[model samples]
Target chain A: MKYPGGIKKQGSSSINYANRGMNFEADINVTNSYYINNDIAVIYKKPTPITINKVDYKSRVDAVITEAHFNTPSTTDYNGIYKGKYIDFEAKETKQNYFPLSNIHKHQIEHLNKIVRHGGIGFILVNFVKLNKIYLLEAEKLCSFIESNERKSIPIEYFENYGYLIKPKFNPRIDYLNIIDQIYYGGKL
Target chain B: MKYPGGIKKQGSSSINYANRGMNFEADINVTNSYYINNDIAVIYKKPTPITINKVDYKSRVDAVITEAHFNTPSTTDYNGIYKGKYIDFEAKETKQNYFPLSNIHKHQIEHLNKIVRHGGIGFILVNFVKLNKIYLLEAEKLCSFIESNERKSIPIEYFENYGYLIKPKFNPRIDYLNIIDQIYYGGKL
Candidate 1:
C-alpha cells in the first residue's frame, strides 16, 4: 500500500487509494531492476499505453501532449529473458481471499496460452496483500481454472496448494524470479 | 513509404510526415499479426511510454489525461518468444545509405548486449526505405561494430556482408522470421 515518489497525486483524498493499486507494480519494477543490475535476468514491466489526442509544440525538441487517454494493453504486463528462456507473466494484487476472474482480460489469457504453446514460459503472480502472500501460478493452471467454471473467483487455498510461494526479500522486494528458478529450472543454478 | 490505416493521425499537415515515419512500424505490426494468426510466432512491439503531468476525472471510470509528455524507452521496441528462444530486437528505418548510430540510444544498445550475454537471440532490423531493402543484423555484429568505432553510421556494405536480407512478401510484408529461421536454425524447418 506504500506509494513511490515518482507518481504524482491529484486531489488529496484519492492519493492513498491510487498508491495502494500502484505499489505492487512499483515493487516489481524495483525487483526487476535489481535483477538486471546483478546480471541475473532482464525482465521488465511494459509501459502503460496512452493515446495522444492533442500535442502542443513548445519547441523543436519539446512536443508536449496536451490531451491523452489510457489505452488497454494487448498483452501481459511483464516479459523478458532468463537463461535463454522467454518469460511472460501478469501480476495482480487482490485484497480478498479469492482472486477475481475479471481482473484478467480474455485476450491476456489467450496471449498467455499462445506463449505456452510456442514453448515459452508463461505464468501469473498473484499477490494477496492482506495476508502478505504471493504465489507464482503457471498459466496452464490459471487457464484450466478459467475453463473449469468452478467459481467466479479462485480461492486463496487453491493457489496455496498449486502455486509456488514467492518469498519477499529486502533487496529485491518481491523475488518472484527466484520462485521461477525453482519451478522452471528445478533450482539447478 | 506507404502508411497503413490503423494509425490515428492528429492533423492534416502532419499526416504525410507521421505516416512516412510510422510505415515501417505499421508494416512490422501487420507482419507480426500475420505470424500470430497463423500460429507461427508471438512477437509484439512495446507501447511508447508517456509521462502523465495532469489528469481530469469525469467519472469513476473516465479519467482523462489532460497533460503528458513522451518518455524515453529503456529497452528495444519488439520482443517475444520464437521456438522457445527469447527474441529481442529494435527496428529502425532510414533514408540514407548508412544507418546512423544516433538513431539508437545508449541504453538500448546496452539492453541488447545484456540479452546476448544471458543466452538470448538479439538483433536489429534495419530498413533502407528509399531502396526498399530490409536487413536483419545480429546484435553481436552490431556490438562489434559499435565497439570498433569504425564509423558514426553503419555502412550499407556491412549490412550486405554480415546481415541477412529479408525479402518483402505480399502476405506478411516483411518476412523477417523466415530469415531468422534460415540463420538461427540453418533453415531446418
Candidate 2:
C-alpha cells in the first residue's frame, strides 16, 4: 500500500502492529512513530518515564531504565508537529465507556488549553477496544466535556453522542494524518 | 529552591540529579521532564521504536512493555516541544574531548535538517562529563561536521572551536530552555 507524502518508505517499523500482546497504546505508538519517521507528519508517543536509581555506564553510555514510577498523573501522552502546526493529544482506550471525558486529567486539560491558546491543534485519539472503534475528538469538544464533567460525570454516551469515530484502516494503519488533512487542513485523505 | 515558572508545583516529579547515576542523557531527561510538568515546557525522550514479536493480552485491555529490541539504529535521543516551538536534539557525554561529532548519527543529521527546514528550533546538547561543561551546538554546524567526518573524523578542536558551553545550574537545571529563550525566544534567561 502506497501512502502519499512519501509514507510507504517510512521504514517497516510502523507497518507491523504488535497485536500479539500489547494493548491499544503500544499499537498506536508503533504506528505513530512509524508515521513521524516517514515524514508523513511528525508525531510520537511519550515514553513512560523511569526513575534511574543508578547507572553503570559500562561503555557506549547505555543507562538502563529502571522502575521509575510517575511522580504525577500525566497530562497528555502524545505531542508533536503536523505540517507547521503543533500537534498534541492523549490516547485513551476504554472497554466500557469507550470514552468518557472523565478519563482525562485536569492538568492535562489545562495543558491542552495552553496549546489551543498558543495557536496549536490539540485533540484525543480514543480507542474503544470493545467496539474496535477509534475516534478523533477535537480539542474543543474535549475541553467542553471536561469543563462540564467537572460538575457531573461525562457518560460514555456523551462521547458516542458527539465524537468523530475514526475507522481503523490498514496500509497506513491508523492513517490518522488523513483526519488531520480533512479537519485541520481542509481536504480528504 | 524556587525555579522560575512554577516548576515543581506543576508535577510531583522533581530533578534529583545528584543521586541519579544515569549518564548525560538521563540527567537531561529528568531535568527536561521536570521542566515539562512544571508548565515550563513539554519535552520527551523519544522511545527507541521496536518491532514486537509477541503479546499476551489476557483480557480486553492492559499489556506490559515486557520484551522488545531496536529494529534499527537510533537517530536521536530526545525531542519534544517548548513554548509552542518544536524542539529537537541529540545528547552525548564523554569524559574525554567533550563529545565527538562522530557519536551522532547520519540519519539524525538528516532528520535535524528536515526539522530546521520546517521552521522549528533544532540543536545538539553536549555534556563534557570530565570538564562538567554542556554546550548547545546548533544543528547546522553539527550537520556540517557530520557530512565531512566521512573523510576522517570530527576533531574535538572543532567543538572547542564553535559550541555554546552550558553550565549545570540549580532552578530548571538542564537550562537548555534558557538557551532556547535566548536563541529561539529572543530574550535573556
Question: What DockQ does each listed candidate score?
Answer: 0.66, 0.18
Q: What DockQ does candidate 1 have relative to the true complex?
A: 0.66
lDDT of each: 0.85, 0.64
Candidate 2 — which pairs collide?
Answer: A20-B55, A21-B55, A21-B56, A51-A68, B134-B166
Task: List ranges where model 1 is wrong by over 4 Å.
Answer: A1-22, B1-22
Give per-residue CA lDDT, model 1, range A1-189, as digits (tens): 334656454544443333434588888898899999999999998877778889999998898998888877789999998888899999998989889988988889999999999999999999887776778899999988889876889998889888888765555777877887887778842
Best by DockQ: 1
TM-score for predicted model 2 compared with the true structure: 0.68
Q: Using Cα atoms with residue i matched to residue i, what is each candidate's TM-score against the true structure?
A: 0.88, 0.68
lDDT of 2 by residue, A21-136 (tens): 24677667767777766776666565544332333444574433322222334446777667866788887766665455467777777777767765667887777666667778
How high is the lDDT of residue A121 in model 2?
75
